[model samples]
Each structure stands twice: as structure tokens, then as C-alpha cells.
Target: MPAQADPEPVTLLLVLEDTETLSSLSDIGEQEGLRVLHAESAQDALAILELEPVDMVLCDALTPGLDGHEVLELIQERWPDCIRLLMTDVSSGLEEALRAIDEGHVYGFIPKPWHEERLRLLLRRSREHLGTQREWMQREMALLEQNQDLIALNAALEQRIEATQQELKQTAEMLDKTYDELLHMHVTTARVIGDLLHHRLPRHLQTNEQVYALVTAFCETHALDHTLQQDLQLAAALYNIGKLTWDDHLLATPSEQLSANERTAYQHYPVSGENHLMAMPQLKRAAKFVRHHRERWNGNGFPDRLEGSDIPYGSRLLGLAVDFIELQRGMVLPREVPRPQALALLRKFAGRIYDPELCHDFVKLCVEKAPDLQTSGKAVISLETSQVKPGMILAQDIYSASGMLLLHEGKRLDQHLMDKLKNFEEIEGRNYTVLVYRP
Candidate 1:
């Protein structure tokens, strides 16, 4: 048979006066995996206790010098962590037994002339107590490791949160600088367009206040923030700035038959806006947005051909507003479709010409706030020789008698027309609609 695993050993201190009893107990202890240190008297056991560490101390209550109670008291003081047990043959010493239990901190009592099974039982209980002590030590070590890990994890999380907060602060500053640049570029564009309008008109011309009013209404209706609303108004006010660099013939030319040069000149507005804005880094982001406003959402429109969501959000909003204001001024072909019809047409081209979401918001805003379209305020339109005081509409299209158009429409005018009026001058048999203005 395979050698049985050695039973767990226990250190025991035995105090006895008789040699026979010590020899008998030693044999039984060896069989049960107990390591015994024998003493002839209680005094000897106390000396042993001072010299070595023991798990349990087994002693007699009535030893000659320094009884079991005396020896236990010394053991309790020196090795307080050790378990103590008292053993005696005299029944008369039972009273002292109670005293040993109370004052000596003894763990148990064993009668003399000890039975083999009884000694085995006592040792087994002591072994179990030692096992419990070891298990407790293991648990304490595991808990200490877990606490250290938790502290490290908490420290790492705090560092990440601090870094994220710092990054957000920088991003906010960058966005602010970009907004200021957009406004400056827009003002420059307006001045150039205003000068051109004055040069072309017979009397005077100016951008309409109705444009600003409509843009403000659009922003409010769509719940756009203040900065975004201002950007939209500025963009619409300056969209036709490149027209100033073109010849008077083209500005007044009908849209249906534009010369090749006229078409090319008209297409340069976005570039003009970009060139003026890119001098400042803060303005560069806005320049990009402005340059791409004419691009189609379906990869088919001018300059950049940016498609769908690829176009900057700022440019998309501006494009929708500019188209609306131009249509109201009768600048576009077909005598500028009515507001309802214009919105309907824009909706059809959403996701192809303008951002689909912005288009939807623009249409909803116009229908809900239709009255803001009425024109107000006066802006000076300066020409080469003289500056117009305030009340002339440039590019007004008058019709011939034969259903042929005779004039063009401007993007903005000082006076707002209540509606388009029909004209029948110079052409035979047919009539056309005229873009009329009141001085």
C-alpha cells in the first residue's frame, strides 16, 4: 500500500511527575502526530514554555512546586497566544480546576490515567483550531491585494477625466475665433456688391432690409442659436459681391441667354468670398464654407461639387437663405416663383442642391413666419460718381408686348414689391410679367 500521508503534527507541552505515565503518553502522542515536550513538575513546564513555542500546554493541577495553575499563568503571560489545558487524578482538587479555568486561561481538563481515544480526541480539536487560524491568515492576504488594485483604478480614472476637460476648453476657443472671421469677411463682400449696384442703376440702389428680417425669422422659427443666425444673415447679405467685378451688360443681361464670359464671371462669387476671407486663419474655416455653398448635394453643382453631408453645415444654411431672398427680389428666372411655390421647388431638390435637413427646416420656417418677408430699412448704394440715398431697385425686369422680357432682377432692392406686375410694352401679340418696384 502507498505510504499514508503524514498526519498534521501538533506541538504539545506535557507536565507530569510519574515516569510511567509520561512514557505511556509519549507512545500514544507519537502514533497521533503529536510532538511532546515532557516536564517532571509545573516549574519544569514553565521553563519549557519560556524556551520553546507550543500549540497547547497539558499540565497537572497538583504538581509539587508551581502547580498547573501557576504554570498556566506564566504560559498565559509569556505565550498568551498558546492554548492551555489542565490534567489531574485527585477529585479533591476539583475546586482548583474551576479556578484554573477562570484565572489561568486553560482551554480544557483531562483526567489522569488518560484513555488512548480521549487523548486522540483532544489533539484532534487542537488541530482543527490551528487549521482555522491558518485559513484566517489567507483571507487577510487576499483582501489586502484587492484594496491595492482598487486604489490604482480610481487614480487612473481621475487622470483621464482631467485630460478630457482640458481638451474641451481648447476646442471652445477655436470655435469662437472662427465665428469672428466669418462676420468680417461678410461685411467686405457687402461693400463690394453695394458699389456695383449703384454704378449699374440709373438713379440709386441698395440691399433690402427684408433679407435680414426673413433670415432672423428663419433662425427663430428653426430654433437656431444666436451665432448661427447672425452667420446666416451675413452670408445672404454678401452673396452677390462678385457681381461688382463684372461688366454692366451682364448684370442687366437676361438669365436665359447669358454669354460664356458672363456665366464664368457669375460663377466666381464663391472664390471671391474665399480670397478675401483666407488672410486670417480664424476666417479660413468660414472661407471654406462660403466657397462650397454653390456645390450640389448630389455631386453635380459648381466649384467644388461637394455632395450630401460633406458640405459644411454653415454653408448649407446660407445657401438656403440666399436662394429664398433672391427669389423674393425677382432676381432668378421665371420672375421668381412665389414663396409657397419656391419652397415646394426647393423641397423637391433637397439632398441634391441643399442639405435635406436644412431645406426642410427652411421651408417650415417660411410657412410659419411669412410676414417677415416684407422689406424695411435703407442701405446706401455708392456708384463711381454719386451715392444713391436709398430707394431704387436694380435689375428690374420689364416685359415686351410679345411675351418677351425686357429687364433683369437684382438680388436686393430698397423697395419691396407687393407682387410681380404684368407688362406689355414694345413686343407684338404677347405679354410678359415685369419685376416692378415703388420709389
Candidate 2:
């Protein structure tokens, strides 16, 4: 490596009135590797301090215009980091030197005529103090930069976290809306299947209405959840969907009068109905309700043979509703049983074929609530396809000109169903006369 260059000398500023004293001090400072700058007055010295990089300042005690003490005080105010020293002769008052030191304007005073060895020693010590202060300032600047970088990074991280939270909220809302649409589609499909069955087997229209009404009343009385109540209502409307696969004679025959093979086949309708509903993922819960609707409280019913309490509550409610409707329709006996006789028969089977509590509630609902639902003298009006609207309950079954049942009495129309009826009429080259409840 090349020989190392000598370090740059520290700059010192000297303010003095006497040219001889300034020259002598400049010679001493230069020998000790100090670069000396001379100012004849305090004003000149202050001007030098503003324009130059200075490491140390020395002032003669008797400088003209401004005293050495006043010059040091000005340097302390304008350049607090610059090290200061005072030069005093034997005639200079000891009180002035003491005041300069006490007021912190000077580090210490040097006596004149100055000794060469002592002057050299003082200059070396002052340069070392200046080096230490510069190093400290450098370290402080570095720490400030690091703190600013950390603050910026923390703000960026907070912004990213807020953005992620907003995205999650939007995703949750979209999922909720998608779920609602899927539920609406599933319900519309079930109603279409129920309408097809009602057209083929006209009696089911009345039975579906009675069972749904009874189930609704029973669930309300028991304070069941709205989700379960809605499931049971859908299951009741679509209960006999499996009968579509049955032979016409088997469907027409009363349950008590069926042959052993016919009864066994009839029992499989619940399973078939569950299979049909399971095709739609959104209807899985209602499918489960339909699958166990025939299960007995004593576990003697077909398919799963699930016992009391083990049977789903919605299924138990459905069992009571279906049996009660079947009895009133005379599907369980040769002649149509009166509503009072149907209630008695349902009570007789409670705890064995039905949940005793639900059976009791069903009886109360039928006796107290059934009368209000009867449309004995209610006005029924016919409407062309263009005149019909959603939310209107059907007052009579709508059939095609060829006697094909298009919709059932008590089935509430919606936009989708109304569209289907219009499409069917257009396809068959006939206009349908839709009957709706007046109120």
C-alpha cells in the first residue's frame, strides 16, 4: 500500500488587536498541525464564523472594539459547538477571566507570554474534543434516518391490513347473496314438482293445503325455528312426489285396503322423494325431513325405523300432518272421515305413530285455527295469463284444455310460476283461465 497521507489539520480562529501576538500564536498553532485564521476585531471574527468551518476559537483579552470576553460570548451564541478559549496578560483582571469561565463562554484561559509546550498541549486537547463531537453528531443523524424508515414501513403495513379487511367483508356479503338465490331456485323447483303431482292426483291439492296449514300452526304454537317451519312446509307440499312412479291402481287404492306388496311399495315413496330432492344441493335439509316423515314415535315405521326423539322433530310434525290429511281425504278409510273423527284417530295413534306433544298441538290447531282458513263463500275470479300476478293464492285448480292440471288450489303463485303457466299455454295453443282468491 502507498504511504498514508497525513490527516488534514483542524481549523482554529484567532481574534486579537496586536499583530505581533497574533503572528506568534499562528506560528505555534501551525507547528502543532492546526490551520490558523486571523480576525483583528470581534465583528470580523463573527463574519468568519458564518462563512468558514471552524473547530476552535481563541480571543485576546484586550482586543479593540469588542473585548475578548464579549467575542467569546458571541461565538458561544452563534456557534455553540465550536470549542472556545481566552488569552490574558498579567495586567488583565483575574475577575474578567473568572467571569468568562463561570459564564461558560470559554473552556479555560491561557496565560501570556504563552509557553510553547503548554500551547501545543492545549491545541492537541481541543482538537480531540472536536473529533468526539463530530462523531456523536454523525451517529445521531444515522439514528434519525433509521427511525423515519421504520415509520414509513409501519404505515404501509397498516394500509395493507385495512385493504385485506375490506376484501373479506365484500366476500362475505357476496356469499350471503349467492346463498339466498340458491334457496329461491330450490323452492321454485319443489313447487313445480308439486304442481305436476297435483294435476295428476287432484285430491292431493286439498290435502297439501291442510297439512301445510296444520304444520305451520303447530310449529308456531311450539315456538320452533323459522328454518324448520319452512322446511316442513316445503316437505308437506312435496310429500307424495314419489307416487308419480307408482301404478295408477296403487295410487288410487286406500292405504288400509292395499295388498302386502302395495303397502311395501307405498312405504318406499319417502325414500324415492328424498332421492329426487337430494339431486339439488340446496334442498338437502328438506330432503332429510321428507325421508323420515313416515317414521313412527315407537320406531315401527318403515325405511330407517328411527325411534322417538331420534326421529327429527320436523319429520315427527310431518308424520302427524300427513296422517291427519290422509284420514280427512278418506285415503286411509273407505269413506271420508269428518274433521272431528280425524282428530280422534290422530290422538289414538299419538305416542305410537306420532309424537304425542305434536299430535296434541295439531288437534288444538285444527279445532281453533282451521275455521279461519276455510273459504266457504270467498269470491273466486278468473284471469287471463296477462292479468295474473305473483303472490295470488289459487282458488281452483288450473287445467289445460285437454284437462291436464297446470296448477293446484292453495298453491301461491310467484313470478317464476306465472311465467311457466304462460309458457305452457302458449305451447299448447290455448289461453288458461287462472282462478285466484279474492283476498
The 0-to-1 C-alpha lDDT of every candidate, in the order given, reads 0.64, 0.79
Backbone clash pairs for candidate 1 read 395-408, 397-407, 401-427, 401-430, 402-427, 403-430
Model 1 residue 410 lDDT score: 50
> How many clashing residue pairs appear in each of the predictions shown?
6, 0
Q: Between which residue pairs do clashes occur in model 2?
A: none
| Candidate 1 off by > 4 Å | 1-83, 90-234, 244-259, 296-300, 304-316, 334-361, 371-439
Minimum summed lDDT over a 10-residue window in model 2 is located at: 366-375
Candidate 2 runs further than 4 Å off: 1-143, 146-150, 153-168, 203-238, 252-260, 277-285, 313-439
Q: For candidate 2, lDDT tens digit of each residue in 356-420?
A: 98788777666545522456656555567799888999865666655566787799999999999
Query: What RMSD value applies to candidate 2?
Result: 12.1
